[model samples]
Target: MTYALHQGDALRVLASLPDASVDAVITDPPYNSGGRTAKERTSKTARAKYTSADAQHELADFPGENKDQHAYGYWLSLLLSEAYRVTREGGALLVFTDWRQSATTGDALQAGGWLWRGILPWHKPQARPQKGRFTQNCEFIYWGSKGAIDGDRNPVYLPGLYSASQPSGKSRVHITQKPVGVMRELTKICIPGGTILDFCAGSGSTGVAALLEGRNFVGIEATAHYAAIAEQRLRETQDGLAREAETRTT
Candidate 1:
């Protein structure tokens, strides 16, 4: 199976891969923020409203809805179908979503026949606050398994309320850039030395985490610019790890 970056559409690239090809799936799909409405895409003018506050400017300009539950589900269904096809039985799928879409997305996964394992709340204490709304300081990761649980040996542990600080400065590189600590923690649950797949690999934080934890990674991105940035980040991570290994050996 292919184990490198493919500079193409995620859906098309995933479709080309064989069934049950990947060991685990960990991704951060679009929150549908840049889209105009749940049903329709954003116009050019509307897309221009992106501010420097976004982690990635191009991603902020992505034409999709942050609240299009139905349409988002449809899109996710295709990805999930492909993800399921490429994931082996007893494999894991870790999906990251904000409070706005977690429940709906989780329900969709259940309907798609994946076993709902549990939810891991990634508490970011330094998240931005809304003027009139409650401060959303956490993003929940819904974990799903391909088949039934194995036994007591594979008991799932609840990752206690982790209180990692979010990135303080604004970044146009990737809007929803997760902390390295969070991704690193998630990688520890899965078996070591297996391949990991991430489709919505914004700035490649997941890829960095995978490499640092001694696992090979394959990331897919739709935007050429973001994909290139992700590739660069992955390369940097690999290089950093190699350096660390050399230091230890010396």
Candidate 2:
């Protein structure tokens, strides 16, 4: 498998790509949850209920520009437009978003010409708790197709509810990083041996998962720091895979 990591803005990098260049898009973009309510809650809390870490340190400290709901929707629409342009017909896009923005995300994808498929819930068993409310234990993956989705012949036959914990141990690179197990399962639903594009590459979890599943990858990250981390992680994953292959042959 081959992969390229671009250290630049996701929109600009995606715009430069050729049409129909990727078979799938699996990305975990920023949730834009840095509003006043969220900020107050985080400030009042000391540690996250799920883990012992400080609440502020649970996720990445990157800048999220979409503090306003309207701005967030507009930004998402622009990004999805590029994703739709680069993705091949029948290709799938599985994007992760928080509950607050899930509806807007779905609307944006529809406006961008993607056929709205359905939502896949990622159940976090170790989710942080809210005392007066339900545990914020689930995130939503908005699934859409470039064109039509044939139910009977879908490549990925997995259930809508995916129960997986966050990345741990050696897999934990980025604060908002997803587990490779979850990514690998999602990657299998893509066109076999086709290219996968992740605009918000973060720590390159998607790229690593794509390559390990025998698919090519193109990942674009805005931050140089995260991009460097992503590159290192991808290199490590590649090396490990190569060693495993050699061992099998020997």
Candidate 3:
């Protein structure tokens, strides 16, 4: 299976794909800051149009006493709704987010008619414990299916938590980048040989994981720089796979 990366807005790119085409979706989208990630780390390598400053300023200027960034709910509503339309009858949507937006996302999904399955806690092993509060090393991933029930479909149990490590080595990747191991685990639970879509795309971890597991992937990134990096990464994976296949044959 081929993994291709596209440089464009995720919401727009996703809309162009055929309906009910993808079997699964694994993504880490913007908390809507468009600039820095949740940790306020600069996505210096990302090619997105919006920046953390833009999102923050927009929220700050929002006409209300409440300065809450319900941005994901508003943006994801359109994306998730489209995701529902593009997913197969029993396909899945795996959405990643920090604690700040988990409940809001849950409510949005429910209101959008998505059948909530379970939540996965992504535990970052290398994360430093927070002071004055419990260690904030975990992120929430909501797994939902197109159907109301998975009675007849294959049973894919969602784990309460998944342990992974943060990126420590040198890499021209975005901040808050997902780990390959985490993506692999998520992919294994989805239908095999299925087409997967990742809107946030990041450094192409989801695509790499999908390719390594013999699945097809299509990733969309808002920034051209990151998209180019992802495309190159996919090509490298393909070449590596080809070499491995040839070695086995020889």
* Best by the TM-score measure: 2
Q: List where candidate 3 sits over 4 angstroms from the true fold.
A: 32-68, 148-158
Candidate 2 runs further than 4 Å off: 34-60, 150-154
**Candidate 1, residues 181-203: lDDT per residue as tens digits?**
87887876556776788987877
Query: Best by lDDT, which number?
Result: 2
User: Using Cα atoms with residue i matched to residue i, what is each candidate's TM-score against the true structure?
Assistant: 0.82, 0.88, 0.82
* Count of steric clashes across candidates, in order: 13, 0, 3
| Model 1 TM-score (2 dp) | 0.82
Residue 90 alpha-carbon offset, candidate 3, angstroms: 0.4
**Candidate 3 or 1, higher TM-score:** 1
lDDT of 3 by residue, 123-219 (tens): 8876667678788678889888888545455466646788988654454255556888788889865677888989788678899989998889989
Per-residue lDDT value at 162 in model 2: 86
Worst 10 residues of 1 by lDDT: 41-50
Q: Model 2, range 1-250, lDDT digits (tens) per residue?
A: 8899999988889989999999999998877653357554333321121234443344444545324567778888999999999998889999998887877899888888899889989998987688899897888899889888665554466777888899765656676788888898889877768899999998898999999999899999988878999999889888999999999999
TM-score, predicted candidate 3 vs. hidden true structure = 0.82
